[model samples]
Target: MARKLTPAERLATAEKDLLLEEIADQSSWDQFLVEQAVFHFGQRHDEWSCNDLRDVLPELGHGFLGAAINSLRGAGIIAHTGRTVPSTQASTHGHRIGVWRITGKGRAIAAQRRIARARGRAA
Candidate 1:
């Protein structure tokens, strides 16, 4: 058995999800490109957060980096470093975001991708 959401809570959830989708769509880069950019970014740094990633990525609207980061996290490509830093965006008002690092599995996969990419180029 589960408690149902109140009408107000449901509406808030819908609105928040809508805003998230809108921000994700606003990016000039598509979802795969966004994911790829962040994935490769992890290879170059030991630990990073959206604040650092923002410097490398293109204009992604508000909080647009989250979906891509979450995707990688879900796939076990990265893991939280058990650290956090205040978000630079004024909208977040200094709230914290997790710092993350690539895992061994992630590094192995990245290496495979690099080899495949180089082979593709050589062909």
Candidate 2:
């Protein structure tokens, strides 16, 4: 079983997430989320819906998430896996929502961005 987070650790994580969101630009934040989603959703075996992502990234505004989803879809970075899952949002309790998975192209782009970020920090 996974260890539970201590209160202090949870607080620190929340602070860090907030600070990162504030510092990052929209595109950068979106890209970061795309990479994060790969891990968050279990890659190819699992998929995430909008609400799922929202739950994981509460710091991101709805408008930002919507735009990011569209942009990634357009760029072929993410695609609907032709699957639908029950909505997790309270407002849409019974509705089915689209499921998305990262594409190979998306993974490639994410990898490149991750490398660039690492290099930037190193420099």
- Candidate number with greatest lDDT: 1
TM-score of 1: 0.70
TM-score of candidate 2 on Cα atoms, chains taken together: 0.56
Tens digit per residue, CA lDDT, model 1, 1-123? 446433223222312224456546543346545666677788899999989888777785334578777867877778999999999977889999999998887777766666766766798
lDDT of each: 0.69, 0.59
lDDT of 1: 0.69
Candidate 2 on 11-83: residue-level lDDT in tens?
2242334466553734356544554453335344456788777766656455466666666576566788998
Steric overlap count per candidate:
0, 0
C-alpha TM-scores of all predictions: 0.70, 0.56
Candidate 2 weakest lDDT stretch, 10 residues: 6-15
